[model samples]
Target: MDQERARLLASVLAPGVSEYVVLLMEGDPASKARPRFGGGRTYKTAADTAAETATGWALRRSFRQPWTGNVGLGCVFFRPNRQRIDTDNLVKHVCDAGNGIAWVDDAQITAEFGVVELDVEHPRTLIVVTRHVSSLDRSDLVGTMPRPRRTR
Candidate 1:
């Protein structure tokens, strides 16, 4: 890892983070490809399979155990070119790659954020998984909105 990336990883892995893992994968970020159908079956493309395997390995190196509770997933994709790709697909690729490794399941992710940007020199993907904490409560809504009037 380069100096900048090392610094970033340090900051994210700092103290006070009770349950979290940060993975910095250095490679061409891959978007989730649509499954191909043939021979009365559906399967992922070779590129997608390779990408997921690589990503899963990286996740395993950083995450010790799967998080059982709801988690918040965040990803930043740095692409080598200005190619058009859906951010949601990129997020999905990472989420799927982490299944059974970083978390119990992708459905356990209750919150998510994703970003795609260009970085020709160092194309990579950075993913952060943190335990989700609900920031809102019924008390917070008190006096924040007007109550509906009863109909006659």
Candidate 2:
């Protein structure tokens, strides 16, 4: 994003949001591969197991913020080793892990955006959760209004 665009968006939306971050173990992409089974049952790979474990550990370390209202989620995945991974595959694993603690449910997340980058030195996924502008409480809404409504 350009500086001017970022500045404009921030100016319009920053004040209404409060955010928090979770640091995730880098490069543990949840395995999407599933071998054929007799009954169509699927199992998790070792990598998937490690990823799920890491997700739980990371969530526990982070504060348990039960924001029932809508959330604005931003995730930055930093891969430690370059092994040609699909960026799209990373979202669900992280978001599902964040379900209860980060927000009421992943469905409550109204705005989601992110980037995938290489952090060879210190690889990690940074998940940021912010209160959505549209989800502010009625009291907060009144306080932020430009002027009081005039009516009998």
* Candidate maximizing lDDT: 1
Candidate 1 lDDT over 2-57, as tens digits, reads 34553443344332445556677787898999999999999999999998998888
Instruction: Compute the lDDT of residue 83 as modeled in candidate 1.
Output: 86
Residues 1-152, candidate 2: write the lDDT tens digits: 22343333333333455354435455544533333455678666676666756775677566444456656666667777787766656766766666555555667666666567776877666566566666533232222223322334
Best by TM-score: 1
* TM-score of model 2 vs. true structure: 0.62
